[model samples]
Target: MTEDIKVDKVVDLKGMPCPMPIVKVSKGIKDVEVGQVIEAITTDPGALADFPAWAKTSGNEILKTDQQEGLIKFYIERKA
Candidate 1:
């Protein structure tokens, strides 16, 4: 679960649309150490697809994801 993941950095993408959400998450990943988890919090529905694509292309691992109400949380571990 996301609650058990130790987050090294958190990026809030609330209200951001499309590419911005993924753009910010891409940048956020760089701020963390490899193997450290970065938590991305977003309200954008597009993040549902963006996050997974990012994890695949970047070779990082998505440790967990939680969604409720309108908020989405992604716990990603840096691999690169």
Candidate 2:
């Protein structure tokens, strides 16, 4: 049930470095409505560590994440 999600924003964070992808995606989705989705595609390994931590601290929801061919896709829902 955690594998599927509907996203409102799709951000391509591929090829970005550790904090950059997280920074940009965090900034990018700040204005999204509550419960709106943000999808991030990243190649940085940091996203795997950073996003879950970010979600926990920021109170957002990590809906889903899928990895294929070294690309990571994360679906997040804004909490407030």
Candidate 3:
């Protein structure tokens, strides 16, 4: 399901640590228009939990989450 999501923006936060991943995602999401999707690629383990929580609080919609090896990918759609 996540594999089919089309992303308008890609934020590569690989190698970055906690908060920073979400921080970059937060900043990157602003570049995309509402209803557009943003894909954040991060190596931080915490992102698995943080992205969903952040999306919930920020009103963004999380379309998908994929974790492969140590990499985490989040497909987020800006709701506002």
Candidate 4:
């Protein structure tokens, strides 16, 4: 895990499933500035694998991710 960055909002996707977390995080990050971070908290097991791929495909940056207490937290930065 990397150091936590200063993020504008923390999206809690704990109960959400699959692409929902990814979709919500994608939408939420759009309004943020370039280099600004957003923290996504999700319990969706697939996010561990999906998000990083999405970030890469979308040209965003997944700065860090950590699994804690069965939840996954991803710190993502908008590239544009």
- Candidate 2 lDDT over 54-76, as tens digits, reads 88888898888888899998888
Which residue pairs in candidate 4 have backbone atoms (N, alpha carbon, C) closer than 3 angstroms, thus clashing? Answer: none
Candidate 3 accuracy as lDDT: 0.90
- Candidate 4's C-alpha lDDT? 0.88
Candidate 3 off by > 4 Å: none
Top lDDT prediction, candidate number: 3
Better of 3 and 4 by TM-score: 3
| Consecutive 10-residue window with the lowest summed lDDT within model 2 | 1-10
- By descending lDDT, how would the candidates be arranged? 3, 1, 4, 2
Model 4, residue 21: distance off in Å is 0.8
Error of 2 at 53 (Å): 0.4
Identify the superior model by lDDT, candidate 2 or candidate 3: 3
lDDT of 1 by residue, 17-41 (tens): 7889889988999998888998889
Once fitted onto the true fold, the runs of candidate 4 whose alpha carbons sit more than 4 angstroms away are 1-4
TM-scores of the candidates in the order shown: 0.93, 0.89, 0.93, 0.91
Least well predicted 10-residue stretch by lDDT in candidate 1: 1-10
Q: Per-residue CA lDDT of candidate 3, range 1-80, in tens?
A: 87688889999999997779888989999999999999999999877788889999999999988889988888999999
Name the TM-score of candidate 4.
Answer: 0.91
Q: Which prediction has more favorable lDDT, 3 or 4?
A: 3
Worst 10 contiguous positions by lDDT, candidate 3 = 1-10
User: Ranking under TM-score, best-scoring first?
Assistant: 3, 1, 4, 2
- Comparing 1 with 3 on lDDT, the higher-scoring candidate is 3
